[model samples]
Target: MPAQVLAPAPAVTPPRAGRGYWRRLLPALAVLACLTRVPSFTRPLWNPDEGYLAVQARILAHGGQLYETVVDRKPPLVPWLYEAAFAVTGSGSLTSVRVLAVLAQLLTAALLAALARRRWGDRAGRTAGVLYLLVSVGLNPEDAQAAGFEVFILPGTAAAMWCADRRRWTAAGVAVGCAVLAKQTGGAVLLPVLWLCVTSGAARTAAPRLAAGAALPVLGAALLTDPAGFLFWTVTGSTAYAAFSGSPLHALTRALGNAGLLAAACAGLLAAVARAPRAASADLWLWLAASAGAVLTGFHFFGHYYLQLLPPLALLATAALHTEPWARHRTAVLVSACACAVFLTWGLTAPRAELTHAQRVAEAAARRTGPRDPVLIWGMHPETYWLARRAPASRYLTAGLLTNYSGGRDGARVGERYAVDGAWPVFRREMTARAPALIVDDSRGKPYAPAHVPTLRRLLTDRYRVVGTVDGAVLYARVS
Candidate 1:
């Protein structure tokens, strides 16, 4: 340095984010997670899926067996999860299940953040978590906030990805298995995880461990539950469910509509990814593809089904954010911010309406029957059981099986088809074993109406008399 002009002081570098940074950031993420779910907190029912799970859980809590005593096409863990929630917070509390959904989201966010941080850095981690919190609810709040299979499977799915990224092959497998146990589509995570292992050069060691770990939960489930029932409902029945689709043109139209909806809701994230310098890694693309396949499995692109796409999208979007300057992505950022604002506002202002048609029927049914009485609902409203505080008279919660009316299709064509080959016998046997005290014919004019099915019409005529109607649902009382 010259005598009068010393070299400029070395430029001071900002300290790399440390434990203190995460210590503060984690709690902030938790707060954001809770805030986003505020809308689901007040509503007693957000979606029919919740009611289905709630009723199943209620039955399970009251000593009913999964698949055998309480039936649904879903895997066993979600019902068990509901049972656990009911156990802690008391049965028939939608708020409790909603609370658990919040916790699941929070946990998923934290896991994604940690996974991104481990792979990328602190900025990417923070962005990933924040993005998940905002975008996870960017769709219809009714589906997004429910304790549905998608919501419950997320934490496990995220954990599986995180573990696979870290080369924790066995843990990744177990997490994926747990996710599958929540929803059959969760097995889609396995492809990305296997790809991760292959790319990481641990395919041999990791593959066996992953397979073994995955089999643990599934085999345990088979042993713990009714093996035949579990297999039929989850595997065989789900396959049939997924296979049901309309004509090719109609299916394509539906698929396109679903894609458009997804694009609109995820515009910010999509834009951010477009602006990125490089495409996401192959494993991530595979993750996205697998999730898309899962969403399309039933050919019913429900808003909630799009939720499986979020973790991958968030990670990719945050990766883009990490590489690009924030100022350059102002439009995407603003779009995302606005999306979050709109979602939160809707949640806060959504009408806490009076009892739904199902609930009104539930109420009327409840008034007519004792606590121990079993009630039957004729349509797709299994939530009536939970609302009525009554046990279901049959294992078939909804009439889909009885009518061959695929839940994935429009109800107009329901009666055009006959009942599934073996469904009516099971229905008759279950009804005979434990006669329902009240039958709510929610599908009076719909295709699945009892009047359209001779057996159902005869049974209702012989054993039940129309007593009342609530909100268009005809209520029938058992004639002693």
Candidate 2:
């Protein structure tokens, strides 16, 4: 009797949608992305490193000069973006450029979400987007303050992946090229794309695909941006930085960590690719590209430089976070938080070395300098530029990368090339000819005085006399 009654009780319906399904989830996540990434609308000077970018952008926007104006090696896309931003907003302050980062990052988050749809379906996609929004929020404080293209790592990766997910080679190539334009390090992203094509080419159903579509845009960007700049990147940015890393394990360790974390994160992506239906794994080609970037850029790799690989990595992390039990994600987030705090503090503080030196020189020189009076700098650090910001009074003297700092190996290198390229000509033709009243050379350094370097001292010969000196630098004048 009880069984008969139960049978008659009618069937209960199953609960189908979770409270935050993918469709409902994305908008909310987008809002959250905007909130975290868009705060502090208008504050902070451009970080010194960023100043070069801003200056170059102004030069390009006005068509002044490309490689000549900005001696730094990278291509011209970031500066161009900054110029266009200035055009529309009519604001050239560091703040205006920062807003562009927000937009780039937002688009990046959206890209990650689209990528997720390919990997884990809707839920994973939305969650990955949310995580991207979170990552953008926690960028180094100084990073938050600047308006440069470094933050595009995530969005750019996402864009490439988005195109790959749809089998859109031309669009994918354009996205990859755009990413490279944003940062030279972004060229590594193509590995993922090629991997997909090659893997697919093996299948009977999959036809031979055009790899040139992706490679061509990046090649075109290199040509348009600066053929010389690309060559310089190979010579200076890549090779020199690699050589620099040889002196310090710091660069090597950070690179290993970035690669290891990326690889661990990518294992899940590879798994997802394996589990995916045919043509499904092409979407993961973005991860391959990002990993390639991590490997190549490990040489001069600053944390901010690693930003390009982060979005795809985070999406892969989302897959990990989603699959793993509670303990791991909790551990990962906490570790990431602590690391971020340390990183943010360092980013905000590290520039002080150059900034303070510049401030001191500027203040001191401002007191003594006249517009027409020539000023000469003898030390080897590039501190004069920063100091010059405050004290534009004296003309900077010295050649082939002179420092405002009193001592360094760079100063040594100039001496090594003295007879061939030295300040002797500058002294006779520029400073002595004009008879400047003051020459400042920052003499102080961690190890010792740069003024003591024989070449610098030797170079400051009979034509210019030592008038005065300071804690770190010194002042010289053409003998009057």
lDDT of 2 by residue, 1-480 (tens): 222221111112122543345458656765665565444343334344465555455445556555443444455567677777767775345566666776777777777766665555555556567655555434444444355557654566577667655556667677777767666666667667545544434323222233555556657766765676565643453333333323245556666765554344333243433333323333343564555556455355543555665665566566556556666555555555454444444444545555556556656765666644434444433334333432222222223232221111233322323322232343345433455466565545422244444544554675567666655677766565
Report backbone clashes per prediction: 0, 20
Estimated TM-score for each candidate:
0.91, 0.66
Runs in model 1 deviating more than 4 A are 1-18, 247-261, 276-280, 329-331, 351-355, 407-421
Give the alpha carbon lDDT tens digit for every residue of 156-223 in model 1.
99999888877788999999999999999899999988877776665778799999989999889988
Best by lDDT: 1
Q: Pick the candidate with the highest TM-score.
A: 1
Cα-based lDDT at residue 24, candidate 2: 82
Weakest 10 consecutive residues of candidate 2 by summed lDDT:
5-14
| Residue ranges of candidate 2 with Cα displaced over 4 Å | 1-43, 61-63, 87-92, 136-149, 202-212, 215-230, 233-238, 244-246, 249-298, 323-357, 360-443, 446-480
Looking at model 1, the pairs that clash are none
